[model samples]
Target: MSPRRDDVIVIGAGLSGLMAARELEAAGRSVRVLEARDRVGGRTWTRSLRGHPIDLGGQWVGPTQDRVLALARELGIETYEQFDRGRKVMELGGQRSTYRGLLPWVGLGGLAELGLRVGQLELMARRIPLRAPAERADASALDGQTVRAWLDRRVRNPKARAVLRIATEMVFAGEPEDLSLLFFLFYMHSGGGFVRLTSIRGGAQAQRLKGGAQGLSRRMAEALATPVEHGQAVHAVLQEPEGVVVHAGNRSLRARHAIVAVPPALAAEIDLGPARSERRRRAEQGMPMGSVVKCIVVYPRPFWREAGLSGESISDGEPIRATFDGCSPDLSFCALVAFVIGGSAGGFGARPSEERRALVVEHLVRLFGAEAAEPVAYEDQDWSQEAWSRGCYVGLMRPGVLAEVGNVLREPAGRVRFAGTETAARWCGYFDGALRAGERAAQEVLEAMRAEVPGDV
Candidate 1:
C-alpha cells in the first residue's frame, strides 16, 4: 500500500504531540498522530483504584500554569484545591516533628538560612532569560557548575543545605550532583520562583482535576478529527527533499513535516538516517531522565484527619521523600499519595512491589500513626521502568552539557521538529510547558510550510 500522506505527522500522543496535532488541525492542516503507548496523556496518567480514581503521573495544576489551566477550563474539567489542613509532618536528623503551613519546624537558624538561600536562588534565576537561557552572558559560568557544587560554595548551614537538596530532588527527580546550576535556576524561575513552585496553597501543587490530569489528553484525543494511532512507535525517519517519511512497525507515512514529541531519551531510539547530527546525539546522551515512583495507598477512611493531621510530610529519610493527603473532597475516598524521588527512586523501584508497598506503609505508620499499617488498596507508577517514557517529571541537564547543546534543542533537525515539556519556556517540566512547546512546534511547521495564520488555536 502507498505510505499515508498528511501535511504533518506527529509522533507520540502525549499532551505535547497531541497539542501540536491540535494546532495543526486548527490551522486547516491534516495530521496523523502516532503514539507508542496504547493511550493518551503521555506522562499524565490516572486509573481507578478500588472504585476511586488515582492520579499516578503529572497531576497538579495551579493558577500560575495558565496554559494548562486555560485548557482545563476549555475542556470543562473541574479543579479542586489540594488537601492541606491540620498539622504537617517533617522529619529531620532522624527526628520527627509535626508543624503547620509552608515552613516546617526546622529551627530558627535553619529557617533563616532557608529563607536567605531560597531568596538568593530566586533572584539569580530571574536573570536567566526564558527563551534563550544559554545565550545569557553568564550562562557559561552558571552551566559549568552543578547544583551540588553551587550549594556547597554558597550555602553554609547543613540543615538548610539538606532541605534544599531534598526539595530539588523532589521537584526535578535528579540529585544535586546530576543537575546543572543554570538549568536548575531556569527551571525554578520558569515556574515563578522557588516559593511558588514548592508551595501548595497557591503554588504548583495547588489544584487537581475532578477526574484526573490524564483526562485532558483523553478529551483532546476524542475531540480530534483523526484518532491517535496507539502502539505505533516511530523507529526510523528519512528526510526527503520534498517531505519526510516516518516508519513505525510495518507502517510508514510521508508528510511535509514531522514533529517528534517524545522525551529526549525516547527520541534517541528513532533513527534519523544519516542527517542526525553529533550535537543532537550528545544533547540526547547528556540530558538524562530523572527517576521517580509515584505511589498511592487507600484506606477505609481518612484516619490521619481524625488525628488532626493534614497527611502532608516532608523528610530527609531514605527511599521516601514526601507525601500528601489525597482524599476526595467529600472525605469518602481516603488515600495517601507519596513519592520516592531521585537516587532513592532507583533503589526503591528496584524492590519487589510488595516490599515497596510495605516500606511505604511502614514509613507512613511512623509519620501518621498505627492506622497506616492497613490499607484497602495500593498502587504505584515506576516512571523509570516505562519503556516509552523511560523516566518522569522531565529531562535533566547535567553540568557543562547545556552550554554546548542548549542552542540546538529547539531547532529543526532537517524536516523534523521537536516538542515536549523540556522544550517549553515557562513551566518547563509541567503540563503548561508541554502545551506551549507543542504550540510552538506547530507554529514552526506552519511557518516553514508557508501556511501561517494568526490567532490559530
Candidate 2:
C-alpha cells in the first residue's frame, strides 16, 4: 500500500506537536500526529497515587505564562492557587528555620547580597535579546563563563550562594557549573525576570490546573480532527523537493511538511536525510536534558498545616532538594511533592525504590516532624529512567555552546521544521513556551504552503 498522506505530519504528540497540529487544522490543513510513547502530554504527566491525582511531570503554570493560561481557559480547565498559606521551611548548613514570607531565614547580610545579585541579573537579562543572545556585544564574555563562576564573583556569603545554587537546580535541574551565564540570563529574560521565574504568589508556579497539567494537552488532543497515534516511534525522516516521508518501524507517513517537536537531544537520534544541517546536528548534540526525579508522597491529611507550615521548603542536605504542598482542592487528600535534582537525583535515582522512599520520608520527618514518617503512598518519576524522555524539566546549554550554534535552534532543515519548549523565545522550558513554539512552527508551515500553492490563503 502507498504511504498515508496529510498536509503536515507532526512527529511527537507532546504539547508542542499537538499545538502545531491544532493550528494547522484550524488553518484548513490536514495533520497526522505520531508519538513514540503510548501517551500524550510529553513532560507533563498526571498519575494517580493512592486514589489521589498527582502530577509526576511538569505541573506548575505561572501567572506570566499567558499563552498556557489562556489555553487552559479555552479548554475549560480550571486552575487553583498553589498552597502557600503558612510559613515556609529553609534548611541550610544543617540548620532549619521557618519564615512566614517569601525570603527565607537567610541572614540580613545574605538577604541583601541576594537582592543585589538578583537586581544585577534582572538588569543584565533585560538587555540580552531572547531570540539571539549570541549577537549581543557581551555575548562572548558572558557565554564563556558558567553560572557558578559568575556567582563566585558576585556573591560572597555562603548562604546566599547556596540559595542561588538551589534556585538554579530548581529552575534548570542542573548544576550552576554546567550552565552558561549568557544562557541563564537569556532564560531569565525569556521567562520575564528572575523574580517571575522563581516566585509562587504571582510567578511561574502560581497556579496549577484542577485535573493536572496533562489536562491541557489531553483537551487539545480531544479537539483535534485526527486522534494521536501512539507507540509509533519515528526512526527516520526523508525530505524531498515535493514532500517528506516519516518512517516508523515498517510504516511510513508522507506529508507536504513535517514538525519534529521532541527534545533537541532526542531529535538528534532521528535519521533525517542528507539535507539536515551540521549546525543543527551539533546544536542538538550539545543540548542535553536536565536530570530530575519528581517524588509525590500522599498522606491522609494535611499534617504540616496544623503546625503552621506551608510545606514549601528548600534544603541543602538530603535526597530531596525542594518540597511543596500538593493537596487537592476541597482538601480531599494531602500530598507533599518534592524534587530530587542535579547530582543528588542521579545518585538517588540509582538506588532501590524502597531506599529512595525511606530517604525522602526521613528527610521530611526532620522538616515536618514524626507525622511525616508515614504516608498512604509513595511514588516518583525518575526522568532518567524513562526511555522516551531520558531526562526532565527542559534541556540545558553548556558554556559557549549557545553562542556557537544557538542561531540555528528554530531553522528548518529542508521540509522538516522544529518545535518544542527549547525552541521558544519567550517562556522557554515551560508549557507556555511549548505552545508558542508549536504555533510558530505551524505558522511557518502554513505560510510556506500558501506560497507554494497560490490563492490557498
Candidate 3:
C-alpha cells in the first residue's frame, strides 16, 4: 500500500510539535501532526472542574520566560499574577510558621546561609555554558557527584539542607540524590539564575495564563494550515536518505522530514531504522522523566487568604510537598493546587483514585485547618500513570550520565529531528523551552532540506 506523503510529519501534538508544524506551514511546507492522546497539549493540560477552568499540567509562566509569554500574547491569551500576597506558610520538623516575604520565619543565620548557597550556585551556574555542559573543564568530576552529595559537603545547617532538598524536589520532581550536580548547574544556568528559577514574583512560577496553559497549544493548533490527527501514535520511524516513514497501528505516513517531539523516554520506543546512532540510543535510555502527581482541590472560597495566608507553603515532611493558590482571576472560584513529587509521587500515584483524593484532602486540611476538609471537587492528574507520558515536568540525568552522553540530545538522525522542552538550551524544562526547541528544530529541518536540494522548501 502507498503511504500518504507530506513535506513534514510531526509526532506528538504537544506545544513543541505544534510549534514546529506552525513554523513549517508558515514556510510554505506541507505538514501533518500525529498525537497519541485524543486531545492536544502534551504536558500542558487544561480542564474544567466545578465550572472553573483549572490547569492540571504545567501552568505557570515566569517573567524571564519570554518565548511562551510572547506566544501567549500572540495567541490572544492574557496573564495574571499568582496570588502571593500576605504571609506564606512553612512546616519544618512538625512546626508551622507564617512569615511575610521570602524568609518563611527561618532564623537570620539560616537565611544568610541559604542566601550564600544560592549565590554560590548562581555564580557557578553562570560559568557553565548551556549547550556544552559535558565539555566543561570539571564536567567529569561534577557529573560524578550528586546534588545531595554536593549539599552534604557544603551545607551544614539542617534547615538550609531541608530547604534546598525541598527546592530540588519541586524543581526537578526528583530527589537531590537522583540527579547529577552538573546537570543541576546547567539547568539553573539555562533558566537564567537560581533566584529566577525559584521565586514567585520574578521567578518561573510568577504568572498564570488567564484561561489555562493548554490554551496556547490549542490556539497554535487551530492556526495551523494542517490539522492534527488524534490517537495516532507513531510506533516506528524508518529514515531513508531522502525521506522518512512513520508508522502507527495500521496507518503509515511518509514525509521529507520528521520531528519526533515526544519525551525522550517515549521517543526511545520508536524504531528509527539505521539512522539512530548508538550514542543517541544510549542517551535516550539514560534520560528518565521525573515523577509528579498534580492535585487540585477546589473550595468554596480562598479561605487561606482570609486567614492572612498567601496560600503557598513548603513542607519538609508532607505527602504534598508544596501548595499554591490556583484561584481564578475574577476571584469567582477558589482552588488550591498541590504537588506530590519524587519518591512520594511514586507511592501516592500508585494508589486508587479515591485513596489519593482522601490523602490530598487530609493533608490540605492539616495545612489550612478544618475548613479545607470540605471541597467542592478534588481532581488530580498522575502523569506517571499516563501511557503516552511516563512522567511530568522533564527528564533528568542521574550521576555520571550527563558527562558520558549529554551532547547527543538534540543531534539529528538522518531526516529525523528532536523537539521537546528537554532538548532546549534556555528554560530547559519549561513551556518556554518547549517553544524554543520547536522553533529551533523547525529551522534546522528547513536548513537541512534546503542544503540537500536547493529550493525544495
Candidate 4:
C-alpha cells in the first residue's frame, strides 16, 4: 500500500508537538501527529488520588510565562495560586528552622552571599546572546566552567551554597556539577532571573491549573480536526527532495515537512541516517534529561496548616529534599507534594517503594511534626524510569557543548524542523518554553511552504 501523506507530520504529542500541529491546522494545512505514549501532554500529567486530582508531573505556571497562561485561558482552563500562606520549613545541616515569606534565608551571612551570587548570575545572563549563545565573546570562558566549580570558587557560605544547590536541582533537575554556568545563566534569564524562578507569590511555582497542567494539551488534542496517533513512535525521519518520509512501527508516512518535538536525547535516537547534521548529532549526545521523582502524599487534611506551616520544606535530608502544599484551590482535599531530585534522585528511587514513602514521611514529620506520619495515600512518579521519557523537566547541556554549537537542535535539517522546551530562548525549561518552541517551528514550516509554493501558507 502507498504510504499515508500529510502536509506536515508532528512527532511526539507533547505540548510542543501539539502546539506545532495546532499551528499547522490554523494555517489550513494537513497535519499528522504521532506519539509514543498512549496519552498526550508529555511531561505534564495529573492523576487522581482518593478521588482528588493530583499533578504527577510538571504542573506550575508563573509570572512572565504569559504564553502558557494565555493558552490555559484560551482552552477555558482556570488556574489558581499555589498555597503559600504560612511559615516555610527548612532542615539544613541537621538544623531545622521556620520562616515566613520567600526564602528560608540561610543566615545574615548566607543572605549576603546569596544576594551577590544571584546578582552575578543575572548580570552574566545578559551578556550571552539569546539566539546563538556560542557567538558570545565570553561564551568559551563561561561555558567551560560547571556551575559547581563556579560556586566553589566564589560562594563561601555553606548554607547558602546548599540552598543554591537545591534551587538549581529544583529548577533544572540536574546537579550543579553536571550543568554549564553559561547554560544555567541562560535558563535563569529566560525565565525571569533567580528570584522569580524560586519564589512563590511572583515566581515560577506561583500558579497552577485548576484542573491540571496536562489539560492544556488534552484540550488542544480534542480541538484538532485529526486525532493524535498514539503508540506510533517515529523511529526514523528520512528527508527527501520532494518532502519527508517518517517511519514508525511498521507504518511509513510521507509529509511535506516534519517537526521533531521530543527531548534532545530521544530526538537524537530517531534514525536520521549519516546525512543528519553533525551539530544535531552532537546536541543529542551532549544533552541528557534531568532526573526527578515527584511524589504526592495525600492526607486527610492540610495538617501542616494547623501547625502554622505552609507545608513548604527544603532539606539536605535524604529521600526527599523539598516539599510543598498540594491542596486544591477549593481545598477539597489535602496533600503534600515532595520531590527527590538531581544527583540524589537515583539512589533514593533505587530503594523499595515503601522505604521511599517511609523516608518522605519521616522527613516531613521532622519539619511539620507528628501529624505528617499518617497519610491517606502515597504516589510517586520516577521520571528517569519512564521509558518514553528517559528523564523529566528539561534536558541539560554538558559543559563546553553549548558554546561549541549554539541551539543546533532548533535548526531545520532539510524538510525537518525541531521544537522542544530546550530550544526555546524564553522560559527554556517550562511549558511556556515548549509552547513558544512549537509555535516557532510551525511558523518556520509555514514560511518554508509559502516560499516553495507561494501563497499556500
TM of each candidate vs. truth:
0.97, 0.98, 0.98, 0.98
- Worst window of 10 by summed lDDT in candidate 2: 97-106
The regions of model 4 sitting more than 4 angstroms off are none
lDDT of 1 by residue, 29-78 (tens): 99999998989998999899877778999889997788899999999999
Off by over 4 Å in 2: none
| Clashing residue pairs found in predicted model 2 | 62-204
After superposing candidate 3 on the true structure, give the runs of residues whose Cα lies further than 4 Å from its correct spot: none
Give me candidate 1's TM-score against the actual structure.
Answer: 0.97
Tens-digit lDDT string for candidate 4 (232-280): 9889999788888899988888999999999998988898875478878
Best by lDDT: 2
Clashing pairs in 1: none
CA lDDT of each prediction against the hidden true structure = 0.89, 0.90, 0.89, 0.88
> Compared with the true structure, what per-residue lDDT tens digits does model 3 show for residues 75-147?
9999999989878778888888877776555688888888889899989999887989999899999999999
RMSD of each: 2.0, 1.1, 1.2, 1.2
